[model samples]
Target: MPCLPHELIAWKILVRLPTKSLLQLRCVCKAWRDIISGADPSFSQAHLDHLHQQVKKPYSLLIAPRIKSESDMEDPRDTRRPWADMKVTSPGLYLWEESQKDIATLLFDISSFPAEGAATRHGLTHCDGLVFLPAEDTVRVLNPATRQIRVLPWSLNSVAPRRCPQGEGHQAFGFGRDHRSNAYKVARFFHRETRGMGGLGMEVFTIGKDQCWRETAVQPPYPFVAGLTATFFKGSLIWTIDYYSPMYDYSHLDDAANMPCFVRFNLEDESFSVMTGPPWYKGPTILTPTLPR
Candidate 1:
């Protein structure tokens, strides 16, 4: 009987082992299987967060090269060498470089690039070792360490294109890790016609049970005056907006008075507010927030 209790204790420790070791322990016994896969939300979330933090490392962001000349082909394969040649050394930023294989590969560190399965050629945003890819209507969340990808189903308003056809309107995305809930949140925004200048609207989506997505109510008082950039920060998706006057034509920017203003999104409250830039900074700038370790 004493031996049985000791064996049980050993199994308990085994189940909580790292992912690779846990996979091996799954074959030890049926009891081990049940214990390891039990529906303990807290335990599961802790394990996931542990795994995510363990592999968090600096990543490079690679952009697809634009074809500027007649010889430039739409096929990424045609200009692979140049894409592969481009690299960025910034820490905590995920970089994607075009590869000879015609796919954008994410290069971490200075070594090899991990091959990501059939990925859409879209813009990528990185946070806490997770890469958010906005591909048309779908957003994919990928873990570069494990090479696992999950597609998030989100409803995007089609009216955005029709309304802002000339200026490419605004699309903002925020990604963050929620320590309290042990879940990750991805939020996107599409501007709508509202009572404000030139009329603007906002929409939000959050991850729900079963790894699904749920749309939230439209947030009023859009964040930006002109352009939008969404990023994950401080356990919430943050939208950074640049302000502009409704009557001011962009062409008149040469006159210093036509400068852009700023706004921000508070994910927790689903609210909007003005964002003041750093005191010493001037001109157009992009801000990306770092998640707390």
Candidate 2:
């Protein structure tokens, strides 16, 4: 009998294999590679949706070693350990061992977060095979299995804004993907000084393109907020403002709230909106992407 069609065979094999196997099999052939790479949105979305439904309960969690600051290291008797654990229900963190430099592709296993004799110097945030490190202004995108790190070009000065003489404030950085463009983007939210003073300015940098940053038209009304936390979902950037109102004055009382609200910036239309959260949920945290079950 003749061999089964490549797509058919691939689909059959993919259904039985784990997420890691499917990721690795993407490198097996050109056709298989394209399919798994999400070049075809419909199929990719379907596969992602199926996987989401299959693992609705809980699979694994990503754990990273906590960073030790100079203030926390004053005690001479303190000892350092190699591993850290964090409970995660979604597939977010990716691991790439430094030792396996050349062939380091992204690992999907939480257990693989701290493999035998692996260094835990850098924490990882995964999007595709890309690993983002926020402790510094730089990002490292690598495939641990292939040990290939595509260091995209960026300006050091652009990322670190100049300090205002009056000590006004600084901006916050967030990284996420734009599904419509199928590109990864880094967004910066700057604080404005006053009304008509350009309340909030957003600069977005897309991956695989020349070093170019585009600014958005929407601006936040309040200028008192100190920090911004952003995440990408459904082709837009969602930002969370974390602010502490000074007791000195109540000028910003109109904008003050106990919980942060979701501020969305649509990449396709370049628009902004204030989004309300679930009725039962409370507190502020980075919004992570979740595949629907």
Against the true structure, whose TM-score is highest?
A: 2
Local distance difference test, each candidate: 0.48, 0.49
Residue-wise lDDT of candidate 2 within 187-206, one digit each (tens)? 65554443234444666677
In angstroms, the error of model 1 at 229 is 5.0
Model 2 lDDT-worst window of ten: 112-121
Return the lDDT, model 2, position 41: 58
Q: How would you encode candidate 1's per-residue C-alpha lDDT over 1-293 as one tens digit per residue?
A: 34565345544554346765655665787765554553444554555556557555334344433223323334546655454233222222234433344444544331222222221123466655566666434566766554566777646453444455334444555666555555566665545444343344555455544444445554534344223335555655544444343422345445333233444455566666645455554654444433332
Give me the overall lDDT of model 1: 0.48
